[model samples]
Target: MSEAPIRLLIADDHPIVRDGIRGMFTADPRFEVLGEAGDGAQAVELARALLPDVILMDLRMPRMDGVTAIKELAKLGNTARVLVLTTYDTDSDVLPAIEAGATGYLLKDAPRDELMRAVHAAARGEAVLSPSVATRLLGRVRAPADPLSARELEILRLIAQGTTNREAAARLFISEATVKTHVLHIYTKLGVNDRAAAVAVAYQRGLLTLDNG
Candidate 1:
């Protein structure tokens, strides 16, 4: 006889996404949809009640974010494996969810088959990451540090906040020429040719994060 289907809990704030995923998984004989949650807080509640074998979690939610939910689940000593399914793969999103005890991370754009494989692996407590996310993690591991200096990071933050070079120079009380030079060095070090790309790469490398507050 075939093994029992993997019990699953689907969580996401979007109804369409939840319904679509539910439809896909419910049709699969190898999986069973135990329940659904609209947000992270609901996810935690349902998880506690259902004790599913796997949870398909979304990072962004209404009440409690996915990371906090994962942490709460971990705190409760819940062994259900969490596989993150979100539209974001930035460090701010990926790192926290992983740190909070996610067994895998897959972007929402992942192919249906790939997502199925990820869910299966997650049910087995195996690590899975989307191609882009895995590549970013590998690059971080290899480089292993904030490549830019403190000053560069500051400039990158300014750029991220839509600061012009002149404005950044004025804020730092530096000459525009010096600011331009720093921008060039930042571009080269980040392997990007422009300011926007530099700021993006900085966030990817964890050199910049969303507001701490």
Candidate 2:
């Protein structure tokens, strides 16, 4: 007997995006587009109601973002695997979604065949990531073993928030030279030569987080 088509729920803020995804998946016999949601809240609701085998989730939404929705689903014991489809490839976006229990992360620019394969993999509870995201993840995984000291981590966070070395020095009651030294140490430890790359690597490796407060 033929297997059942994979049931799918799409959650994206854009109507046209939803339309395109729905049309693409519905055209395939191996998949079924069960429903569409305009935001994470609606996605969570529909996911509970429909119990789709996979959910194509977008990162940014109205009520809640994809990561929060994924966390909520996990908390509520929802069994559907989440596959993130978004334009964002930054570590800030990819790391949280994956950490929040996303089964896969795919860029919006991915080919139709790749999206189909990602959906299939997600339905099977496998992890999938776009090539760029995979490379970023691999780099983080292979990062140098030098861990940042507590003060260096603090200075890195301040830099991530757009603080200048002088401002960080003032905030920490340290000399500007000390802050610069710490910044350099952070760069070396994170395997990056610049402040932005250091912060990005920090977030990717779970050393930094979005302060909701």
Candidate 3:
């Protein structure tokens, strides 16, 4: 005999999105669309009754957010795994949902095959993450050294060349006030207070060199 299909509960604010996702699963015998929820609150309610293998959660819902729903499910000791499915993959969105016990994270842009695979993985209590989300998590793990932006680096290079903030602003053709803001950010990033100290730290970090010598 064949193995039973994995049951799914999709939760999204849009009826159209829920329908579209349901269609995807309905076309395949490998998965079963148990129910659709219009909001996180409804998702939690439906989950109590449906007991699906995986819940495809959306982060921003009207009644209760996805993260909150995941937390509630955990509090209730529900065995079903939560798989976050949304367009957002920023740190603010990805980290909280995972911390709330989401078994997987897939962006809305993911290919259909990947989405199905994500659901299957989630059903088995395995971790799933969209490429962008995975990259974000990896970046968090190996946080960058200088958090300095490209513009900030340009400003730092000018400072290394002994240019005043005004001169740098003039060369960059930006407002002096804007340049001051970049300078402040550079100082904060380099952990320095003044221009000279900022320059010293930049050289120590190999962000600058006395190329003239």
Candidate 4:
């Protein structure tokens, strides 16, 4: 049996842009454009009503912006993953969208293949960002001071080196519970919510030297 097509809702203020996106997805058998909205409010309403598998949202729509829409949709308990498509690639746009619960961010000029890949990735709960944007965002942020104790820093360095928490604990002669506490502290100090972000922060802040392997 064939797999179900990925259901999508497209939201963009510009008719031509929305039409272009609609045409691109219509040509793909793996995707189905379930609905289209010309503004953020309509997008939120349609999303709540349709419950699509994914939403392709443009950031600067009139009436309500994509970020606001994303925030509101999240509050409504909508399950659809939001994938932000916008011309802005700066940290200002990318970070706010991510904080608003967007699962992915893609440039509006992204090739059809990349867009499709992002949509599918978002559907699976993975975070995606344009390479250039990711680089810029990662570069600007300074790493926090070693919030963890000296012992905890040792464990985090090991974890950043791909060691399992249990492995790190054993190597440190500490219990797994202690390692977990350190890991939590690392996350808190970094203001990051996931392992990937934590790793990026560690690498950028020089907490984990690249040659630590």
TM-score of each model, in listed order: 0.73, 0.80, 0.69, 0.66
lDDT agreement with native, every candidate: 0.89, 0.91, 0.88, 0.86
Window of ten residues with lowest summed lDDT in model 1: 204-213
Model 2: lDDT to the true structure: 0.91
lDDT of 4 at 174: 85
Collision pairs in model 4: none
Candidate numbers, best lDDT first, in rank order? 2, 1, 3, 4
Candidate 2, residue 11: Cα displacement in angstroms equals 0.4
Which candidate, 1 or 4, has the higher TM-score? 1
State each model's C-alpha RMSD to the native: 4.8, 4.1, 11.0, 13.2
Predicted candidate 3 versus true structure: per-residue lDDT over 49-142, tens digit per residue? 9999999999999989999999999999989999999999865578778888999999998899999999988888899999898998888678
Candidate 3 segments whose C-alpha is farther than 4 A from its true place = 144-213
The per-candidate count of clashes, in order, stands at: 0, 0, 0, 0
What are the runs in model 2 whose C-alpha is more than 4 Å off? 154-173, 177-213
The TM-score that candidate 3 achieves is 0.69
Number of the top-ranking candidate, with TM-score as the measure: 2
Q: Output the TM-score of candidate 4.
A: 0.66
Ranking by TM-score: 2, 1, 3, 4
- Model 2 sits at a Cα RMSD from the real structure of 4.1
Off by over 4 Å in 4: 141-213
